[model samples]
Target: MTQTTGTAGDPPYLRIVATIRRRIADGELAPGDRVPSTRQIAAQWGVALATATKALTTLRLEGLVEARPRIGTVVAGSSPAGPAAPTAPTARRRPSPAPDTEPELTLDRIVRASVEIADAEGLAALSMRGVAARLGVAAMSTYRYVPSKEDLVLLMADAAFGEARPADAYADADVPEDWRARVEVGTRTLWGLYRKHPWLARVGSLTRPLLVPNLLVHGEWMLSALDGHGLDPTTLFDIHVLLYSHVHGLAVHLELEADAEAATGQSEDQWMDSRAPVLRELVDSGRFPTFAKVVGSFEDGYDLRLDALFDLGLRALLDGLTPVVEG
Candidate 1:
């Protein structure tokens, strides 16, 4: 699609803001009509994700649009100049409610609120102040419960990891007899958690792992599965780490892709499509015959499905490890 550009001298984001404002003013986008998402705005306006986000923020502040959970940004019911609505400024200026009206601030509440913010807006948008803002308390209020942003993130990761109780997955009678089956269940459970909270993948890494108790529960489950196999400690632990790394290594892309999409305003498919010329040039070079042949063999272009890759990698890992573990 052709990029929308505003007046020559205007800033890129302002141009985007003006374009959307005109659409609303001209009745093209009515109240409750969902506006283009940040990615869409980025692609259409040929601007960065930050620019698109800024344009939307401006619209929201102007009372021209409102963000609806699960619905996205939509045109506001009232005009921007109408009676002052409960916008950001209004929310910021809201008088503190009576002690009875305000809910008690607890560590759990603070962590949950922080997770919600991270989940909805991403980890980058998460801040101590933002958490407090979301919780409707003083910025310093969250500090009383959680020492700092780092500590809060650790708590959030632990809480998220706690959601899936690995031990509870297999009850007394329902436990899988085969070690491979048990490992599969454990790994898949971890994968499911990562899928739910994409940002969780970015919390820690292989070299510097998250030492939270909840995360260790999953580790315990995996280690327990291979316990009675009579394998040496080093080999067994190596196998476990390998399996865990397979899931984590692939899962890291989940958040990275989301971040890239937000920053570039291009979906994975769009990004790949834009690289078609590069791919074509590589294929035409004749130096990479095998790569070209494999790529050309696809009836349709390859789509990188992470879920499928996870399953394939898991099976292959198990297959390779079977001989080693069984012996």
Candidate 2:
């Protein structure tokens, strides 16, 4: 039986690179195929953009892929055309306790260790020094494996995403007859991941997308859903962005609430209770009858009301967008 050990030594980015390299070598990825972008890598790996980029850069240096202008990175023809070589004894091994107590730094070890650090303390706490401390090694030694903090983060993000296998269940679900519902399923799945790791909301920037394979699954699904809608390429891209923004913007609030609850140890209900007296006093002053009426009933609370709001907003947005997409 294989004994499962916790991730205590490896950084996530290197593992991400290794996973992708293995996929390429195993013929899962073919020549000229585009790799995940920096943002996608970050989302998938659950690390910062820096680490995901580093993982990609490592692959590039190893002659696995070439980054092309405009077209993005594509798998290099030089990438091995067969299954990856068997893992060496050292590669299959995990870190063991030592008298000096330092873990051997492999790309896998570095990335896995870094992921554990971020998962526990949050990404803000991740740094070369922090990761090195976890590995019981000098910060400079980590550079031998990851080169820089940025690359390390990129790897972390991609690896996190790679953790979730694409839903094979969706294969039959994406039927031509029910594409809208299919798109919703994909969005909600991603939203659930964000809810699990609320910190994920802060990782991917709206401006600079990190490349990772898992994230593109959502995009690919949405684009395919719009295929029969008769939208132009630009319109399809716009619709995709709009749908993404709707889900992500709402999901971001989940992260904020998580942080707020952690810092205050007070649920939104409790916080509202503390604020109620002052709010009522101001509203009852006869200057804001409208406000008084709105808060007159807190029995349902914001959480209860949020579901209605989501349904209302989604319908309104879709109502307006449906024509444009179908046109």
Best candidate, TM-score-wise?
1
Quote the positional error of residue 244 for candidate 1 in Å.
0.7
| Residues 1-327 of candidate 2: C-alpha lDDT, one tens digit per residue | 011221234467657776787678677889998777545566777877557656666577578887553234579977743323334434543323334434566788888867765553345546786566455565467887788878888888676655553354456654545656656666666665654544466667667776766677667877887777767798888888887777677767765664465345578889988997898689789888877777676566545444455556667777887667655
Residue 138 CA displacement from its true place in model 2, Å: 3.9
Q: On residues 162-203, what C-alpha lDDT tens digit does candidate 1 reach at each position? A: 999665776675787689988999999999998878789899
Backbone clashes counted, model 2: 53
| 10 residues in a row with least lDDT, candidate 1 | 85-94
Instruction: Give each model's clash number.
Output: 0, 53
Name the lDDT of candidate 1: 0.78
TM-score for candidate 1, please give it. Answer: 0.75
Structural similarity to truth (TM-score) of each candidate: 0.75, 0.59
lDDT of 1 at 99: 51
Assess the local accuracy of residue 3 in candidate 1 as a C-alpha lDDT between 0 and 100.
Answer: 19
